[model samples]
Target: MDTTPLRVAIIGGGVSGLSLAYYLQKQGGEAARPIEVNIFERKATLGGNAETVWVDLGNRRHPGKPDSPYRRWADLGVNDVNLATYHRLRTILGEIGELERMKPLENTESYFSRDGSIALTDDRELFRGVSDPAHDLSQVDGGKLAVLMAVVHRSAIELVESRRITPRYTVDDFFDACVATPAEMLAAAAEELGVTIDWQDPALPARLERLRHTIYYPRISAMYFADDRGPGGMPLQAPFEYYRIQEGGSPPDRRYFEHGSQHWLEALAAHVTDPSTPGPRVEILRGIEVEASLSPQGVTLTERAPGEDRWEADLLIMATHAEDALPLLTFGDGLSDTHRELQHILGKVRYTRSFSVCHTAAARLPPNRNLWRTYNIEVRNPEDTFFPYRIDYVANRHQNDAENPAYNQAGLPQYFVSLVDDLNRIPRREMLERRPSPLDGPSALAAAAPGEAGYRDRLPPLDSDLEAKAWTLFKHNVLDADCLEAQEEIARYNQTTARRRFEGRQDVCPLLFAGGWTRGAGLQEQCLEQSAQVVELLLGKAERRADPLRLVPTGSQARQRHPQARSFTSVPTGS
Candidate 1:
């Protein structure tokens, strides 16, 4: 007699959900055990916040290939994949036979607009006086201060790695363990590493402050949420272990898929759904919003479509954002106290809004001839009247690819650029819906103008050639104090649950959580790592022929690394 296949249901079909499905399918194929997998995505498309839409460059630009209209694919959501720290992502790409598709980003010289003169940055000269205090200060370029900051950053990374510490629990814990301020963050590491720098330079403080306002502030603002109380809405936390090199060096050159980052999502979706595979085939249901109720036995998901309105699974994985996933479930009385507490802990994360606008126009890019194909431009004024965030350009990557005989056969438009709006001054949906013009509207510059921090027109005037445009908005929580508290609560809960399980008592949930927001510093690589962990948990249970969704560690140190990570910590069948 054949055993019934294990049924697994995943919510939200973004990278996390897809990753779980991919691993489950792999397990079923190898173990000769049937595993049924289903992904329900609310959006019409599969990728929750990551999707691709092609831009028709119009037949006018195609010339002899007018029949093809020079169509170019644009990523509406999700951009580059950092190769150095994204171990799980790289592994997945290799497994799926897409290793060669990884393309490194070309580093171009960046510019900072200041005092009526645009200052340029050459990466080579960035560290000119980094070790020597005798160098003439007057000969330095724009990124001089950045070199010192880089040393500080390196020190922090090494400090964490040397102690074998991964502080995913809380920013407070991190700050308590490591040095507090940004300036002294690397003090311990610098001494150990034997790197020399003039920390006592007379002009160091002013230069550091300048770097903060001009570069770091805008970067932090973009990556985090706006805190009117101060810039501390999200506190700096230790970087993830996987994000740094073994030697505790800087991040590697970023890479992207030649076809666009969305290709990974599409490929995973295709893999699990391929019917030719040996194990139970994976089923993907798009354009479906589900209402789920959890009981001791399993999960019942309710939808609107006929025959698809309901689903019962032995395990339910909430792979969507906490805000979106929490509402879909009805935590009935049947749920144990452990599970309920887990819910409250997961919900503590606060997500901030994000906005990105992509447009095809040469004028949107900086007019500087020395600028690289990809670069960051920060607009500022002489009197420090407006401190606008850095706007990134993506035109050079597309143009450089046009040289390859394999791409752009139809001669697509040469320029493509995108700007990620700072949290303090996100462009209104109305403002982005129409054609973007000179920086006169309520954009970065306009919003910062009244404050008189600094001022400058970041981009050249928009001309008639602004042919195509697109925009996307989403929410992500920065690694702030609240996020740290959530991490701490979850860690404690997991430890308690683990002890109960060891005592042969009934405990833990039949659910697993996987997402960037779930843990590990909230980045794309973390999402992949979390998903891999879910797979390890489930497969370990399978080896023991135990409960379908038990949160067992794959290795000795696996569970210890993220003790509070199992979002689904209660098992109804236990006890």
Candidate 2:
């Protein structure tokens, strides 16, 4: 019997890569031989989109307290996790013992027009004095609001129902059959709700247009789907089933980590590296870019750094964005047909760049403070209807001690994470000052006597002016029709190769792929799910399944399938 450990190389140290390593170490314990896993991350940090920074509240501490300015953790990238839908992620968190750190988030939202007008708001306090009937309506034309709500309701129902019957249904079909036909929509609404809707009202068109630009387009298309191109964008042709799985059921019960998203990511990293772990020796190589070439025997990864180190692995798992993965596949020796095909599919996956800024920029929120909610969507340029220019998340309302009166005092301090397409909107001075923490722990605050000589030296430089704090630019995968199709194609290809190996075929490619983009909506849940699937295949468990090619369900389906069942063993397996 072959006693050599299975050698595996995972490129890209994002959530997918880290989680893959964790599971590989975990499941490998049950195998006859051990597994040797190496994770190569080009970035200095482990987490890709999950970035957490310590916000130094310099000198803003409560009076009479020596720890005047305390520091708080804020997430610049992926912040909130929906407890209702994130089954796989929740399971992984439990295994790592960080599930207890989850805290509920106040996820109220408000939309604002470019001219500082409150177009729509969920804050009841804003309409406190208005009549009871008026208070219930958004700050828009009553007819327009009614029309918008009716369409949204009908469309959501249709989307869910259509997805249940037809898996290939796209959002474009939904728009054509349900949304674009306003006459039919109005008639159905009037009949179903027993309310009169005047389709012929002279001002209806303009009012509907206002609602589209201010509320519907921004909130639904841009914020929820991240389709900045609006109706004309890729979201229109994307599969509706994915969206239903992500946002379909009831409103998601959202929560954030007490210490920020980096907390759990760091915990996962620590778990894989912990000396107590049994079997599957895992090593993390940081700041190293590797070029990969594939052959029948295995994969060869050559470091792109000074030493140009190289390693041989029986299998290679790419846990990176498709575009990023495409460039790393070198054809120095030769390339197989499957390798060229994968490169072509990966090349088709598209990405767009956006800036995420963590700052105290109150100006980015609703001008009228009364309308501010946990999330504020501001339309900087109403004419540019593609997407809302800026979205500011009120970090204060969701993070540590948010309800404590001491921390809520006027002029103390506030933190906001703004997502914007244009960096010029932020002040130039605050371009890039603070660096992201090394994911170890919070950066220490300077604790020196105010008048002491070493006071200045002790403290890290604090920006007295409270505008922009820290910013990071990220590339977001554009989940349009073509991208979704490519993901399906890749999944099919992987399954085909796995089946070939099961049938004792010699020409199968040993290369595998795992990432959020591999399945439904590219969120943290999908990232973990895809990674888990890859581990199952590597462990030879795929042959036991009834359908080896079946795609794992995510969101609600995942919740029902798992039901608090631990996917991996809790005990330390091998050393």
Candidate 3:
């Protein structure tokens, strides 16, 4: 029996990497030997994209006194985590004993902004913001909304059922199974749902645009439609899932950690680094850029700093964002066919950039408590071209109070607005020309059209804000061409290599792949699930016992053909 520990190298220190470390440490025993895990992060902080802000609310004991602000934590990057949708994340939280920290978000109403007025909706999924209490929606419009809902429902079902039977089914495969592009599907569904309206009808185009702007973009984040310009939708070829709405829970019914998303990520980091942890000591190398190379010895990771330190590991796990990991992978002189194949597949994965601004400006924000008594406000503007959508009032004060009574006693107000802008699409020269002062308020960064004065006036005054804006790399492939090609190639690779490789050798070429981008919808749950699957693969999980009826056909004709047949030797294994 080999007792030598498996030395594993993990790239990137985000949730995916952290969770992988957590599982590797916990499940290393099943691998026949202890495991040594080393995590390399390029940034000073471990939690990538999951950033939090601790605001200092100045002293209130003596109004005129000069006292430093109290440090209270709030989220600026990833907003909320859904309990119903994110089961894997929930399980992880439970393992870390932070499950109790999860709380339900307060119910809030959404408003549509058009012609400079806000209209509240009774049914957030379908309706627009209208002033009239009894606004009558045209039958055609109502039918369109119903059809959209049906598609969303069907997509969710297909996603769940497919994953249950074929865990290897990539998200690209899910969308490929759909009937048409989201727009075309909407038009077809309308007819099926009895919506009688000409495609060229004057009102229909506007309705579709509104639906896309107010609902689809935010719900799916432009996954279906490639861009903002009407619709010359992407080619629908890959088997990818769309509009992933988890059944039973409304999308708006989301929960946020009182301390922030960073709290959860930090806790995960502590579990690996803390000396008191029960598992083998995991070394975390921060602020180091590692270049990965392959050799007969194993995986070699060379740091990019002066007098660089080199570390060799038995296995390498690229847990970073696919794009980030692609550049770090260096093919040595005797690269195997598997390494080349993986590099080709990874190249097809496309990504787009998204920019968001987080600021503390209570005066610029609308009321947190609406006349309808909702705790938060979601505002949408279809007319503003630069960044049409914005979440005006994300008041953490209300959430803090609801989660803890002691928090409310402080009576400090903290509000933030996040905008999802497609900065990558805009020209570099234009953005640079329009860029405003760093110290300036929201108006400084506003991309409003000319003569759109007073538009910035509605926003609360920006007192202080995060110095570094939230810039993110979003994995995007609308048509499924890239996803499908990647999936098929990976399927072939897995069948020949990933599945055939025995647990006897620790040195392998095709290192494990794990991230939300590799799975369905690129969500938190997908990230957790994919990383877990990688861990399971590394452990060489045992196959479940086969059922007697499963191996032999139970039909009358089949039973007659093989009367004595009970169960076959081969059994299905869990991944």
**Model 2 Cα shift for residue 230 (angstroms):** 2.7
Q: Rate the local accuracy (lDDT) of all candidates.
A: 0.52, 0.62, 0.50
RMSD of each candidate?
10.8, 9.4, 11.4
lDDT of prediction 1: 0.52
Comparing candidate 2 with candidate 3, which one achieves the higher lDDT?
2
Give me the displacement of residue 554 in model 3, in angstroms. 21
| TM-score, structure 1 vs. true | 0.71
Residue range 1-575, candidate 3, lDDT tens digits: 77888899999777888888888877776677788999997765655656554434444454577664454544434556667667778877887777887776544434443333543433332222232333212232545543544554444343332223232333333333332234432444444445454555556545545544444443333232233332123222122232332223454335676565756776778767777777766888876779988764578889989968999887788876666676888766555666677878777666543443334544334332232212223344544333222343344532535445565566655544343454333232222111221222122112222111111222334322211222222223332345435544543454334444464433446477765456554456666766776777677662322321011113454233222222221222221
Q: Which ten residues in a row have the lowest lDDT in candidate 2?
A: 447-456
Q: lDDT score, residue 69, model 1?
A: 39
Best by TM-score: 2
TM-score of each: 0.71, 0.78, 0.66
Task: Sort all candidates by lDDT, best to worst.
Answer: 2, 1, 3
- Tell me which of candidates 2 and 3 scores higher on TM-score: 2
Give lDDT: candidate 2, residue 145: 75
Q: Higher lDDT: candidate 1 or 2? A: 2
Candidate 2: tens digits of C-alpha lDDT, residues 1-575: 57997899999888999989988887889865678999997755667777666656556544576654455667767787876778888888888898888876665667776575555565432321222233234434643575566554544444343223222333444444433445553454445556566666666556555545555556554443355565334443243344444444366656788777866886788789787887588888876789988776788999988899999988889898787786787543444688678876776576766767777767777776656667777654746655633577877765533444555553446777787777668665443334334344522212211111111222355444422346666566666555666776777666776667567676777788987667655678778777877787777665444333223333554333222223222422111
Candidate 2 lDDT (Cα, 0 to 1)? 0.62
